[model samples]
Target: TDTPVWVKGSGAASDYLALHDRPSITELIATKKAAEVAYKSSSLTAKNIDLAEVHDCFTIAELLATEDLGFADKGDGGNFASQERGLRNNGDVTINSSGGLKSKGHPLGATGTGQVVEIFKQLRGDVEKGRQVDDAEVGLTHNVGGSGATCAVHIFGRSPND
Candidate 1:
């Protein structure tokens, strides 16, 4: 059975510059911190992740997430996404294979739980055939709470019950 480790982070109100106003446009600072804690707690690294469900509220959000989660270097998010490193279910870290919030549709309060559900299914090999990440032993879920002010990151894997 695979155990889980989690972490969370919140940026300060003073850090609330416009989304476009941040010094590091390519960075998601809260995500970075949250991911750091999760990995530290779990004693794993980005390369160990098999798949992930991230808040893709926008295309840009997904891009920044690639870097924030340590799957790619800063400023190389787009490249990471395009170069078969962050693709669906087979890349270094399969990203948003549940079609993301864009195609899967976001249901406000249920979004975070929804992400967990997808990860739960994925780890169980319960996702659709073409979408399943083979040997999805380590799954990560990233839920952002509005405008990056707060965020939660969790690492999961197979459970004894499953």
Candidate 2:
């Protein structure tokens, strides 16, 4: 059995907050909620993930994503992205081995699927050298649109045959 996209998204409560309540920009409640749903649906947690591809419309977006996606603790996203901890292609829980949306030319509507393609290659051991996560059995993709108004989180894993 092949693993298809196990996806989830944020909803109303956070939507209201994003508009008026304005709790905390760093919180990224919308993205965080979607991540929660995705993890639950996949029966996995951030620690269980082997790699991830996240939106990086700006540098700070990556930081928010890492924490919201559960790869790092609250307020630790910056350090998590730093060199000491390694989220590089070869590190534990490798992040953005595909060079992410920024390097991929940020093709707007295509960014989400592009993230999927990277995860597909990584899971199938088909990506080029120096950028494939070693033995990546599970991966995630995080995509958000227009100032955090919409978010999508997806979990992918190896097929039973693979």
- For all candidates in order, the CA lDDT equals 0.75, 0.77
Report the lDDT of model 1 for residue 120.
80
Return the TM-score for candidate 1, rounded to 2 decimals: 0.81
lDDT of 2 at 36: 85
Q: Write the per-residue lDDT of candidate 2 for residues 23-99, one digit (tens) a residue.
A: 77776777888888887777778887888899998899999989888888999899888845343444568888888
Minimal lDDT window, size 10, model 2? 5-14
lDDT of 1 at 81: 72
Q: Per-prediction TM-score, please?
A: 0.81, 0.84
Error of 2 at 116 (Å): 0.3
TM-score of model number 2: 0.84
- What lDDT tens digits, residue by residue, belong to model 1 across residues 56-147? 99998998888888888888888877775434434578888788887877777788788888888887778888888787777888887658
- Per-residue error (Å), model 1, residue 14: 11
